[model samples]
Target: MSHPQIRHELSKIETNLRIEIGQLAERKQIGIDSQGTNLCELIALLTNAALSDHPLFSQLTKLDAAFCQLDIGLYGLCSDCESEIEPERLILDPVEQRCALCAESYAHEHRHELRLTH
Candidate 1:
């Protein structure tokens, strides 16, 4: 995709991520009342688990960093090969910094390294 199109898409994603993060924070801040019934307490516990270490929260953090990179004009370049990332891949995940081949290679190497360490 063109730079402008990429920028526009990333901007939209960034905005949505920020809004989601804000909502999640608000939910966290409204602590469940200790005096509530058992059901309420159970619901609150489930909500807490959903909010904490959730994939959405992690994605928000990643997208925030991606926004920073976009601001500096380095969004679509593959980190490993310094090649332009495919536009389709970018559409699938604007925060992805590496092309498919490079990402697979990196993952493979990382897994191998983990095996060695273990």
Candidate 2:
């Protein structure tokens, strides 16, 4: 994706994350920042509170990482090959850090690990 598109996409992701956090915080009576909260720490707190119906913690972590990568001007680059990630893949999940080639390779390399976790 181009830089402008990526910035727009990240904005949307941020909005969604904020909405989810707001709803979850309201329901749990937890305090959250209006902007710039630490995603991992906030989620950890929510997890400790035993929130149900929340997004998976790992998913939010990926999103938080995406925002950080964008801040560093590396949002659309693959973590492995450093190539630009396919635009379609980014649409499906803006948090993806691997391009198609590396994703397949990584999947093969980590298949056993995934199975164990699952």
Candidate 3:
């Protein structure tokens, strides 16, 4: 697909997701007013919503913005070696503008940060 097409699609998804997230946030806030609810359960619900729903959707929005720039050829090249990013990797993760080598190095360097925190 063309760059404009990809960007347009991403934008549409981002807008829709933002609206959904806002609605969920409002609902969650309303839930806090419920009387006699278990405090642990309430905290768990809010934490789950923020960590899973909110962050997942928000991350996609950020990725969309970054990908839009890449689509216009502004950040399409890898920063490390100045090589063009592989099309396959880009297809897998459209927001990824780094080449394989640079990406691998980055992942290796930050491997510990990828672990799940509880």
**How high is the CA lDDT of each candidate model?**
0.67, 0.77, 0.58
Kindly list the per-residue Cα lDDT of model 2 for residues 19-93, writing each as its tens digit: 777776787687765256667676666577676345645566677788889889888889999999998998898
Top-scoring candidate (lDDT): 2
Instruction: Give the clashing pairs for model 1.
Output: none
How well does candidate 2 score on lDDT at residue 92?
A: 91
For candidate 1, lDDT tens digit of each residue in 42-96?
3344356575466665665556556666778788888789798888888799888
Poorest 10 consecutive residues by lDDT, candidate 3: 32-41
TM-score of each: 0.59, 0.64, 0.51
Badly placed stretches (over 4 Å) of model 1 are 30-54, 109-118
- Colliding pairs, model 2: none
How much does each candidate deviate from the true structure in C-alpha RMSD? 9.4, 3.8, 9.5
Backbone clashes for every candidate come to 0, 0, 0
Residues 13-71 of candidate 3 have per-residue lDDT tens digits of 55555455446657667443222333234335446556444564445544554564654
**Structural RMSD, model 2:** 3.8
Ranking by lDDT: 2, 1, 3
CA deviation > 4 Å runs, candidate 2? 1-4, 22-55, 114-118
- Looking at model 2, which ten-residue stretch has the lowest summed lDDT? 51-60
